[model samples]
Target: MRPLIAIPARFSARTSALRYAAEVNARSLIEAVWRAGGEPVGIHPADTGTAARLARFDGVLLPGGGDLAPPATAPPTPTTPSTTSTPSRTPSTSTSPGTPWSRACPCSRSAAASRP
Candidate 1:
């Protein structure tokens, strides 16, 4: 059996397919996962019963969209400004010991430096 990948569908104000605005996931993303031998499952972005629902899936894909709430603590400033620019690199994936399966996609190359 293919690994089940739970993808949270984003809420869209308007879409071409439906008569009215609806919650949706990108078709390209779904197809890509399927092509890669994983079953993509669209998950409702609700808090109720989420843990139970997610427990059934082998992995979760948190696609980019929506506004992120500001962190409780203030963001830190860079100690030294970068003088040279480097080519953008893909984010590395790592799993924590004894934790649920998870992946990280860096929004920017400087994402690590911004962490307090």
Candidate 2:
């Protein structure tokens, strides 16, 4: 069986085709995974049960999107203009897996630590 790679779809306030808010994934990412002989699955980020949810997948791929809200303890920085009107499209700092949010999701570390 092909490896099932779990990719978290980004939450968006609006999308062209959808009347309600939507979850979006990158077409290039999905196609690349398929070309590499793996199946890519997009998942919604839940408030709870993250571990139980991730345990079923063979791997994880984190795609970059969304605003970068700095930690409360960090020194303040000047505000920058948002790129788009949508709340989800605000100018983001680096969205690499090393950001503060990763600490909340253990799977980030687990996926980075595991062997292929």
Summing lDDT over every window of 10 consecutive residues in candidate 2, give the lowest-scoring window.
Answer: 84-93
> Model 1 over residues 1-116: C-alpha lDDT tens digits?
88787889888888997778787999876766666566888988897877677777776666665464223112332643332222112336444433333333322223334445
lDDT of 2 at 84: 24
Considering every candidate listed, which one attains the maximal lDDT?
1
Cα lDDT of model 2 by residue, 1-116, tens digit: 87777888887799888899998887877766666666889999775877678777766666754454433223433654333221221123223353322222223333334425
Clashing pairs in 1: none
Q: Which regions of candidate 1 fall more than 4 Å away from where they truly are? A: 69-99, 103-116
- What C-alpha root-mean-square deviation, in Å, does candidate 1 show against the real structure? 9.8
Instruction: Quote the RMSD, in angstroms, for model 2.
Output: 10.5
Q: In model 1, what is the error at residue 105, expressed in angstroms?
A: 12
